[model samples]
Target: MKNVKWFAVDIDGTITLNGNGMVNLNALSKLRYLARLGYQVVFVTGRSSIEALALAIFGGTTQITIGENGGVISTAPNSHKILADIDKCRKGYEILRCELTHVNEKSVFPRMSEVVVDRTFNLDEGNRVFKEKGQDLILVDSNYAYHINETKINKGFGLDSLMKALDIGYDEIVSIGDSTTDIPMFNRTKYSITFESSTKEVRNTATRVVKGENGDGLINAIDWIMEQKSYCEII
Candidate 1:
């Protein structure tokens, strides 16, 4: 759309080829092209802010990144804002560790705001435990891992934070993702895109569903956006 100035994209299943954490060169190149065309591209992902920041630095996108499923927002190499309470996440993790079997932390980059664990336990059951215990924690599956974060925090919250920081409005952005964690982001933006491989919920939440998967899907989305009459006029 003509008002669109920023592209908020999920990194894992959205841009990474096959969701294996491999960078999709073609998709990355498209993002770089968007940057060259004066559109800001921000990486919004479930990975650690540090990891996502690194990708932004090398991927030729904006320097800012939203990571840890809206729990962390990193703007520079050593600068970041923590939006979730790590102490609460740790408490939830302890409770889960004691009540469930095989619930262990996953080995990942150092996280500043949340706890991540393997997808070895029932996510609903884990959240139920939190509810019964009067905890404000929630367990969200990114399809890559399970994250323990504050119930109020989500990608939409992260996007809001970014909007405030950048002095932009939600209507000026388009979100693209392929997972449940991305639903909040989809709801916040006027235009959202997802792949055919995404879950029904994700596909339904998005404004558009592309036929391609992963990196291919991202390329298709960019191409489609570029082909729009308003977008062409703006360019």
Candidate 2:
């Protein structure tokens, strides 16, 4: 947490448990405290831009959010910047939809820039088909869902946009996530934290791995960071 001014976090599976929905109250309390300590706490998530806005408003964030697996920026409530062209995304979906299994629009969450479906589908084949079509769309899997976004759109890109908007540098941000999509953000920041339940690759790539899982893990990471900085006022 040294030199850190912002905490970019993934929502589902990072700050929220399997049944906690958005996040547990305890985790949200800790996040609110962190924001009160004058740090920008951002939610870089695979959830929709509207959900990101709700989380941001609740956490008192610096109005910077990365949603849709880095394909969308919720710059303000009810307003969003979509990284992928809507027409291209629709076309790609039309092609990729046929390759999926046990999934459809109903199984997917509403999103601004990309389509998010359950992991029960055939992800590998979907990617292959999209590539064969020469579409710029790419499929990214997070902790619990798969996001189809533009080729260059990812957590890192969304974070870069947020940082630029805030006039913040990479070194001042701490990126925490629990999925492969987070690897890009890990590459963009100095402080990277992953949950214990994260994939082996993510844990190995992250700078630190907290002991607990999900929301509890996030709290643990925050406690460790605060300890490193020797600041206990949040308690």
Candidate 3:
């Protein structure tokens, strides 16, 4: 890979083969292979940083993880950098809970900087409520659940923070994902890959949309990149 030294990947729909959160071992293996090739693989996800860290540890990738969709970053086992105000997210959640009775909290790993709720209510209605109440919070659908995050934070912000911390440039990374939440990351990177299962907006945001879905799609993406003479000059 030319100047690319890092692979930033989303976990849920991007690597998980099934909707029930079953990981695709094949994709995990492919990530491991990339790691062996000196490409640091970082998990940038909406899932809890702890959970993503665990995946990184067990999957034999880099231990760094960006969690809560740009609100939190885990650099070590017991250390995390909080990027967003969880209090504001909590406040937004409370407002939504009070206004939308059907908006129930989803049972998820403990979050450090965001609130996650089940995808049972209309997101536009929630956005309208936030707009009317002047809350600086936004709801994002991760395809696995709904996340209430700071209006100013996103995966791109998180990745930028990580890049700065690691002394990596923006152009030194490649991003992969399957949802609109990953669009910010896509915009920040020169090479972004999404799958056919992603919505048109997400596909349009990516530099390329690969065939297949989930882990199979991830492998296909790696293969496609390997075939690109511009990106695979040294490899």
Best by lDDT: 1
Output the better candidate (2/3) by lDDT. 3
Q: Each model's RMSD to truth, in Å?
A: 1.5, 3.0, 1.7
Task: Pick the winner on TM-score between candidates 1 and 3.
Answer: 1
Instruction: Put down candidate 2 lDDT per residue, 1-235, tens digits, no spaces.
Output: 4678789988888778773565766777888888888988888877776787787786666676788878888868767878776567677777766655565653654777887666777788888988888988887777467777888888899888878877888779888888888999898888899988888999999999988775888889898888977763443
Model 2 TM: 0.90
TM-score, cand. 3: 0.95
TM-score of each: 0.96, 0.90, 0.95
lDDT per residue (tens digit) for residues 1-235 in model 1: 7788999999997789878999889989999999999999989999998998899898888898999999889999889999988999999999999888889999999888999999999999999999999999999998889999999889999988888988888678999999999999999899999989999999999999988876989999999987883656967
Misplaced by over 4 Å in model 3 are 229-235
Comparing 2 with 3 on TM-score, the higher-scoring candidate is: 3
- Clashing pairs in model 2? none
lDDT values for all models = 0.91, 0.80, 0.90
Per-residue alpha-carbon lDDT of candidate 3 for residues 115-139, written as tens digits (9 for 90 to 100): 9999999999999999999999899
Rank candidates by lDDT, best first: 1, 3, 2
Q: How displaced is residue 14 in candidate 2, in Å?
A: 1.3
